[model samples]
Target chain A: MRVEVRLFGGLEKFVKDVRFGEGFPVDLPEGGRVAELLDRLGIPPSQVFSVLINGRHASLADVLREGDRVALFPPLGGG
Target chain B: MGKIVRVDMTARKVTVEEVPEKYRLLGGRALTSQVVHDEVPPTCHPLGPHNKLVIAPGLLSGTPAPSSGRLSVGGKSPLTGGIKEANAGGISSQKLANLGIRAVVVEGRPQDGGWYLLRLSPEGAELLPADDLAGKGTYEVTKICRERFGDKVGVITIGPAGEMMLSAAGVTNNDPEGNSSRYAGRGGLGAVMGSKRLKAIVVDSPSLFNAPLKEPERFKAAAKRFADILHQHPVTGQGLPAYGTNVLMNIINEAGTLPTRNFRFGRFDKAAEVSGEKLAEVAVARGGLATHACHPGCVMRCSNVYPLPDGRVCAPIEYETAWAFGPNLEIGDLDVIGELNYLCNDLGLDTIETGVTLGVLMEAGVIPFGDGEAAIRLLKEVYQGTPMGRIVGSGAAAAGRIFGVTRVPVVKGQGLPAYDPRACKGNGVTYATSPMGADHTAGYAVTANILKVGGYVDPLKPEGQVELSRNLQIATAFIDSTGLCLFVAFAVLDNPEGLPTILEMINAQYGTSLTVEDAMEMGKRVLKAEREFNLWAGFTRADDRLPEFFTYEPLPPHNTVFDVPGEELDRVFDF
Candidate 1:
């Protein structure tokens, strides 16, 4: 299955050949969990604080489907 | 340890009195709110002589505690027509605290319409004629004050917009570097000050951090631990210092919550061009700074200095200001945004109110969307007090009324800050129910809703949002009283030891055995006081609502509307 993954707030440093706010395709197994995708992208669970699927908050245990738009971020805050 | 300096503008008399026993323990927002609630009538016209402006430092101000120099300015808000406490970061709070001042209450309007400056030192405070400093920008007023009084003296002043008694005006004070960009820039507190006919305040204190401590060793240890905790937090220690608040530009844009072009969309196509990374890159290239501090003793320096093309600098262009002027107005050019920010800083106007007003004008077709030059030209007219400028400076709500635009984004007559509540529902809940109308900082649920700090509450969901905003509002009210910058919440939310250390420092300083529960009660009491005042001032549950458009209009790209039920919002203050 193909999914789009985006990284923000300098979390792109953890991924190979990725830039902030840019989404790239990632191939994952059918019914893949967010944890597996993080594992595939070499992102430690502790390093990432937020995961969003199609603009809604998602957790690591959430199952991913093909063409899912996933975004990951380090802990970030501002007014 | 505490004295209230009462300055009667009508009588032209300055009197120093011992802080009454009932009000002795309050500080910062708590103190200012108490003063306003006790002395000023709730139904009084906000700019009338009956309205008093109260300025106070927090309980832990003028101490060695890191980032504990925030000042709170409170009064009847000309904009909201209710109780308002606007917070800011600058050197003046600590200076006033060091001088043993609990609060400065400006009472009675001047019968003579002449401007006066209040000069304070260890000896005392006195009102002096400021006619020579009239009609000047805040920067120039601050500069002349600093030059006349020693350079180290803290200068607090308003600008021509305030002088005109515009409801969008804000009170500004100089940072350590003498930039008058540190402002209590909400609720039109500057208009309250302007109505008092007070032009500027020069705080000449030799002692910057002589706040008396009961247990110096214990307080020192606790303060050190708190500073360490702040440093350990990645958001406060690293992400903020690297790019400042504008770092959220890309993150919020990606979350599809960045309100673009007057809330018509959820994302701006030119977001990256005005992002923090771009800001840092350009700022560093132009001999500017990407990170600085708004006040002394701040460890988490998230402020920035962006030098413009005209060789002038706009210190600390915050995220809310950036969003209000950039994406919301469809003006993505950083230089133009900086120029607008600089103009607001000099003119004593609230940037959020001003930007949101400009967005309304664009929505009305008064100016074309994305026209940066037109926006700049319109903003410049504010200084001249032109009729058009007054409309723009009257804030978002008034601008909407005059233009016959129903899409006006405001609550309780105050302009909403950067976050679009429809997409970011937690912040939306906060905007609706907070005692201070439409203020994001009142309960900044963005930490959980979008930034993924504290914890994750789905930004688009209605569930768990009430609880999130409730807890944040309580915690925030308490933090505002401690003279600590609200940004410290990034560390406090993540670290279990954060609150305890802060309490230990406060307890050691004042010799009060206050537990976390007691401190929380202080927060609740502050809210109760504010709510009571607002209720008396005629704010109902209907007034405590987002604009009708937020629920009716669906924002893209998620196509979500603010769905948080009003009954759930009422439960926010159930405690």
Candidate 2:
């Protein structure tokens, strides 16, 4: 299965060529969890604060389906 | 002894009086609100002679405390028709504090309508004829004041928008770089200043950290601990320094609470194009700073220098302003956003109110959506004092009424900010019930609702929202009084020692053994005073509501409407 992943708030530092919020497709097992996607991107789960699957909050154990849009962020805030 | 300088604009006389004993513990919003409630008649027209403008520095403003240089400007809001305390970051707060001034109260308008400037220094406070400075933009007014009164002096001034008594006009003060973009940019306090025929105030003080401290050594130690706490937080130490407040663009967009295109959608397709990442990239590429401080002793430095392509600079384009001009208008270009931000700063207008007004105009078919050039042209009309410009400056609610657009996103006549309350229910409760009327900083529930800073609360759920907003609003009222930047809450919320460390600094400075409970009580007192003032001004439970559309309009992605019950909103100030 293939899923689109985006990084933000300096989480993009884990991937060499990806800019913040730039999405890239990644191949994953049929029922891969968010933790598995983070492992594939070489980003430590500790560095990621919030994960959103298709614009809703998701956890590391949540299963991802094909064509899912995943966004990962570091601990960030502003008003 | 701290002094309160009262300037009678009607008589053109200035009198310096001792601070009242009751107001000794109060500072910033606490002091400003108390002064406004006591002096200004509740039912008087906000722009009339009865309204008095109170300017104050926070309790720790001129002390060695880090990021404690906030200034509070208070008045009866011309827009909201309620008591207001608009806060800003600039050098004037520290200057005023160091000069031993607790607050400056401007009362009674000049019958002759002659312009004047209040010059303050250690020698004395005096009103000077400012006819030469009339009709100038804030940037020019600040520059001229800086040149006349040493470059080190801090200048607080307004532009033609204020002079024209626009409801959206805001009071602005200069940063260290002399950029007059540090605005108390809400509730239309600038119009109150303009109505008094006061053009500017130049605070001339040589000392920056000479405010009397009761326990100097203990205060210094506590201040150090607070600074370290800020530096240790990733949000303040790293993310903010790298990209400023605009960093929230992507996360908020991904969270589906960005409020795109006048709240028609929850997310903007090109949000990243104007995100903090893009802002940093373009700012650095154009010989501008990606990180800067708005005032001295600011360790977080979550401000930037964005130099536009037109050779002008908008010193710090904050998250709310960017969202207002960019995603709110469906305009993705950062340069266009920068231009609009600069125009607001120069015109002394509230950027959020102007953007929301422009959105209402677009909905009325006065201008096309996503037309950045047209938006810029329309904003420039405020300088010309045209009818269209007056309508624009009257804010979103007025524009909506004039154009017959019922989808206006406002509470208490002030416009809603970047976050859509439909998705962020905790903030929704705040927008509805806060005395300040739709002000995000009044009680930023985004900490729990979206950012997961203090604790995690489901953003889309109505459960636990009222309690979340209530607690935050109380804590925020206290913090706003300390002259500390609200961003400090990011660190304070996560760390157990944060609130105590802050109290320790305050206790050491004031020689008062105030506990966490006393601080909480103080916060409650501030809110109660504000709420009581609002009630006296004829605002009832009906006025404490989000616009009707927010209840029915389900925002996209999460597909959530603001479902927080009105009865629960009434509970926000039950304390």
| Best-matching candidate per TM-score | 2
DockQ category of candidate 2 = medium
TM-score of each: 0.96, 0.99
**Evaluated on chain B only, what are the TM-scores of all the candidate structures, in order?**
0.99, 0.99
The TM-score of candidate 2 is 0.99
Residue B458 of model 1: what lDDT?
A: 81
Error of model 2, residue B346, in angstroms:
0.6
Q: What DockQ, on C-alphas, does every prediction get?
A: 0.51, 0.77
| Model 1 docking tier (incorrect/acceptable/medium/high) | medium
Which lDDT tens digits does candidate 2 get at residues B377-480? 99999999999999988899999999999999999999999899988888989889999999999999998988888988898999999999999999999999
lDDT of each: 0.91, 0.93
lDDT of 2: 0.93
Pairs in steric clash, model 2: none
